[model samples]
Target: MTSPADLIINWDVARSTASRLVPPGPSLSPAAAAREVADVRQAAAEAVGYVHTITGLSAAEGLGEDQRDVLVVDRPGWSAANTESFRKLLRPALDAVAEKKPQLVSEGSSAQVFGSAAAGAELGGILAFLSANVLGQFDPFHSSEHAPGGRLMLVAPNIVEIAKQLNVDRSDFRLWVCLHEQTHRVQFAAAPWLRDHLMSSISTLSSSTLGRADGLPQRIVEAVKSLRQEMGQQKVSDQHDAAAGVPARNRLLEVLQTPEDREIMSHLTAVMSLLEGHANVVMDAVDDSIVPTVKTIRRRFEQRGKNRSPLEKIVRKLLQLDVKAAQYRDGQKFVGHIVETIGMERFNTIWDSPEHLPSEEELHNPDTWIERMGYTPKG
Candidate 1:
């Protein structure tokens, strides 16, 4: 049997490489950095109240103030936090992989060292890229005896940089970002079972996929090559498709080996879409009275996607971030339709239990979910 150590990737390498590879965060003087952090903390605190009022989800009973505190971090800090999350989240799947392919780890010590380093470096690169782009995230998997509910994190420098790039009011942008992330915090807070449900679902699917991961590495290489080629062709054939990067995303999906894997992926996608979409809805739900530049922010943010450099676009496609963007749109449509048709109070039932969640098909066809949930059809 492969030892636990062998099953686990060398996360230290991942952390260190990410630290080295991640771009330095936007420039800020000591005072400016302090001010930004304070502002983010304040935004997060205020956002919690707005998210509660908008979504009707509050911190679960018994959550401590420590668990609810928002941590404001820079690029490297964000990278480190996510690295830990990946470690915890992937542990079970890696164990399953090791069990299925004991020799995969039982190779000579030199091979183990090289394999760990290689895998860590690859993950590190992805983390480094994402660290630059992510403004804020709520990590539900983080836990300790003192604070079992996990912490919310805001990447201060990235938020500042993106706001500058978008040429929006800085305070409005900050609060907008907080509103989205705070919704996520409120989500897990309201549905305490959600954390375990997601973790279980992810582990189950990941185990099966990793177990059948023959030719996985070759598939990844081919996927990238094909996406790059498709991107180039789309540049000549259709500028819109080139920017959208749909083909690349489809190619990436080929990594799943079975129908069951695809089903699991779909289910997970739907859940993510709901979470992301609902957050987006809540963020936008606040009107001009609160976020005065809300309309302008939304318009420019959409345009920012169309304005990425070719290299950044390629990176985004490779990371499946384009799919994440789609989730927001698809999910937003589903939530918006449901909320408009039935109202937010009725919409709250979706979070009542895992069974109440929408399936992938239901996301595209919100009427199906509504009907299945025993709601009256829209007139």
Candidate 2:
């Protein structure tokens, strides 16, 4: 008997609950904290200049001249910031849903109160798991209309903990992290339309979800059943060769009942893969003299991904981190293939406009993208 309004999540409560559940770890000594902050700031600047040089984009081009600010925060701070961002992003869709059905909440009904509390708890649990593992994030909405650029957020405690766990040289690892994140900044700066394009796509998806909310529960159940069947088939295929498991598909996208939902998700996945892949390539392309431990760091990082604990792996799967990791690998390979075949100058067309962006299928087969882009591979 719960109304749809009752399901509108109380994200503020969720943010607070998540922060409490995943509180920051042991505090760094004052000197260590200060040193870390300084190093990150320096790295951020260096990375921006380095990426600009490598990408060959200047301010006169679409690249914005504004500088990106860096903020170092603990886990709790990060959780709070991201919760607010999610709230902003989701509010329009929620409001649209309400407009379509005015009677979702009856006057004097307590269902809304109870539903909000329950939704908050669910969201809190998910965020609690994610906050621990996220090292850094680039938030496009961090700035106001007057300020057109974004900010780079470094989760100080998590970064420090990860470095300690991996036993990597502290400076090298921190710089490496900054390099990847900064590449993202350069991407947005170079392609000012990208932020709007992503936001538009996400809004479209959210609106679609809202329009289909009435059947959402049933759709989700059906999707789960379909997924289980697919997994069974995958297991049978795996039995032939344990090392060659089924290829990783975007399982989340596969679960959507509507073709529209699946299409939006595919576009989003392709865009994300391109961005992450481009960042990975740039980070690795840094001269060895710049990062003496670059090879060791890369090896250890890949090992960390492969050796996650069962609990951690479940959490990752829930948050779609597994999908993100797959995107990184797939994207990196796609970028490498295209660059090697057509050369970087031709490959750079992908950034020229939305039309130049590859489709999800094209991401798996660079040759298709190459042909589509009217580029012939070198002999």
Which candidate gets the maximum lDDT versus the true structure?
1
Model 2 lDDT on a 0 to 1 scale: 0.76
TM-score of each: 0.88, 0.87
User: Cα lDDT of all candidates, in order?
Assistant: 0.83, 0.76
Worst 10 residues of 2 by lDDT: 239-248
Write the residue-wise lDDT of candidate 2 on 1-379 in tens digits: 6334335777768887898899566578999888887777676666666676666656323232334356777788888888777776776676677678654444345766666677787888777777888788888766665445667788777778888889999888888888888788777776778888888888888978876888878877887787666667765453232233333334534576378877888899899999999899888788767778988888898898888899888777667676788889899999989988988778887888999999999999989999998899887
Worst 10 residues of 1 by lDDT: 60-69
Q: Write the per-residue lDDT of candidate 1 for residues 1-379, one digit (tens) a residue.
A: 6445444478889999999999988889999999998888888777777877777654522222333457899999999999989888888888888877776676567767788888888889999999999999989999866448778889999999999999999999999998899888888877789999999989988888777778778877876776667666755344344555445446456543467778878889999999999998998799998899999999999999999999999998778788899899999999999999988888988888999999989999999999999998456
RMSD from true fold, candidate 2: 4.0
Q: Distance from true position, residue 272, model 1, in Å?
A: 0.4
Model 2 TM-score relative to the real fold? 0.87
The residue ranges of model 2 lying beyond 4 angstroms of the native Cα positions read 1-7, 59-68, 103-108, 145-147, 220-255
